[model samples]
Target chain A: MTDSWLTSLITATPQEGFELAITLSRRGVKYTQPDPEVLHRLRPDYANSADSLTAASHVIAVNFQTVAAANNYWRT
Target chain B: MTDSWLTSLITATPQEGFELAITLSRRGVKYTQPDPEVLHRLRPDYANSADSLTAASHVIAVNFQTVAAANNYWRT
Candidate 1:
């Protein structure tokens, strides 16, 4: 995504990103994509699992959308 | 998925499936989950790339959701 494209989301708690999403939300106004290794481990336990995290919905959406894009790229 | 778990989708024309999806949509009423090889190739070209197909929204959704699930499982 472009730089300004990500400025749109409002996380319930900025900290929920790292706490619930395993993301580095506390660092800056800009979000670099999370490390691939971290992303690998932070996946939802099941479909819609991230729906329950109150403060990290944006992170959850980011996570799901990234994977969905990758999936769109390589179906397998 | 269970036997009944797959009875949910309605692919239009049914024949457009194999054409647009690169899938074997004609054989049965139940969806067996496309082959891993075929799945790998039929993925949308971009985020929501499959949105253009007129007869296969179901296939696109299935493809997107499958990759999303796989992404949720592996994260990386």
Candidate 2:
């Protein structure tokens, strides 16, 4: 039911995580945090610290048109 | 210098790729094709078929706030 074509799962400190979200929001890109249970099921390796999800690095999702463009924005 | 915090490298057929791009564009998201040389250097495993890059599923990077969000959009 979603219109998003691609998603990016980024892991970063809480500060960086929110910063990226803000940046995307400013550009009018939609993004959100993955559900903890779902994330744990999908990527167990990175989901070791569920409690630390909000304090440590977190994942972010957004829609994009091309790989190159996504990369540029992700790095930001 | 980019605002993106994470990147997703999606692999789908050409039709699917363009379709996703269109979907994102309609949503006002920005995306582009990764530089062939840069993509090869960054991900040698997925760069085996440079010639087929356009024909095969391509990578699409984007910024996100959480892993869950990225996963949802990616599946779309």
- TM-score of candidate 1 relative to the true fold: 0.19
Off by over 4 Å in 1: A1-52, B1-76
Please provide, for model 2 over A3-74, each residue's C-alpha lDDT reduced to its tens digit, 9 standing for 90 to 100.
553234243444454555434322231112223443334344323545433222221233222222323335
Q: What i-RMS does every model get?
A: 17.3, 14.6
Off by over 4 Å in 2: A1-9, A29-76, B1-76
TM-score of 2: 0.21
Model 1, range A1-76, lDDT digits (tens) per residue? 3444344223432222212222323222224544666554653421222122212333333443343343342332
> CA lDDT of each candidate?
0.31, 0.32
Clashing pairs in 1: A76-B40
Q: Please give, for residues B1-76, the per-residue lDDT of candidate 2 as tens digits.
A: 2665325525343223334443443233233544556544644332232222211211122322122233333433
Cα misplacement distance, residue A75 of candidate 1 (Å): 3.1
Instruction: Give the range where candidate 1 chain A is weakest over 10 consecutive residues by summed lDDT.
Output: A46-55
The local lDDT score (0 to 100) that residue A57 gets in candidate 1 is 31
What DockQ does each listed candidate score? 0.03, 0.05
